[model samples]
Target: MRAAPARRGRDGADTRARIEAVALELFAQKGVAGTSVRDIALGVGVSEGALYRHFPSKEKLSRELFLTRYATLAAEICAIDAAERELERKLRAVVGLACALFDAEPALFAYLLIHQHEHLGLVPEAPEANVVEAVAQMLRGAGVPPGRVTLASAMALGCVVQPAVFALYGRIKGPLAAQADDIAAAVMVVVEGQARG
Candidate 1:
């Protein structure tokens, strides 16, 4: 019997993903500055050379991981069907999605939040800007004032979502999940208030 040839692309992608996952776990446990490529390779049961083949350097890998996660989050947020729903429902949907993402990958969220300032400079500015724009569009679709849309979006994201994530994952003692509904409701109130007056 002839042996089947390995699928190079699929195998390579799997290996790369494994390397990234292991690297992220290590980075989360030990701060990025404390983790090394050799450590990542060892964790993934690959040689340093093999790891380098997938990611040229640790810094490059970290940046790629950060941007990839952020892009995924932005995509989820942008996919909300705000135009098809009531403003309250839309706001709840957005908040629910944000909470689910944070809960699903709290470690990644924590790592990104903690290191955002340092890694922000490395990411393409467009994706983050696009997230803000998407938020503005969603708010506009909800009948929020054009002038207040950006501010409302910023407050929901920066004040509400960010703190909620930290409270959920950080050392701060609080029932983040318990407060999710209230937070969503509060955000909706702000949006509705802006839309009405």
Candidate 2:
């Protein structure tokens, strides 16, 4: 009956969610290239065939997971760019958000950070889904020279990202959010192009 179908749908959705969660954990622990569909299926407590009922292949699942999370972060960064007008304030907001996310969900954040290169080319071409473009757009709006925008954006993002990387490797102690203000200031230096020999 209809009730039986509804229950199956709920179970199917739960199974899919479990698959995604397990896949992300494995992907974080082992690089995407290192993780296998069997690994994900085993972790999720589902048969390999059942996993395929949700994702056709491991590559598709990895791409889907990467794009989904990356787009969410990109959208958030775009929203921050849209809301803040001042350059320093905008930098602080964006940096703070990145650090907070790293602290809140280290596995998800690490997955995104480490696997970005593998998946960036697959990202859809949309301003709201391109974090780099969003940061560049913010820099341009803040009066950073057109010629400098691209480099400045990379440098600015690095000011936040590198710390998270260091924290990930245990070289840095404590939550990244604690360093947000300093990171923001460092990003400002990049944006301003404060020359130092």
Can you give the TM-score per candidate against the true fold? 0.80, 0.92
Model 1, which residues run further than 4 Å from truth? 1-6, 121-129, 163-165, 168-177
Residue 141 lDDT in model 1? 79
The residue-by-residue lDDT of candidate 1 on 20-139, one tens digit each, is 888778777787899998999999998999999998999889888887877676666667753346666766777777666566766676667766776766555453334556667788
Candidate 1 global TM-score: 0.80
RMSD of 1: 3.2
Give residue 70's error in model 1 in angstroms.
0.9
User: Lowest-lDDT window of 10 residues in candidate 2?
Assistant: 188-197
After superposing candidate 2 on the true structure, give the runs of residues whose Cα lies further than 4 Å from its correct spot.
194-197
How many residue pairs collide in each prediction?
0, 0
lDDT score of model 1? 0.73
Please list the C-alpha lDDT of all candidates, in the order they appear: 0.73, 0.87
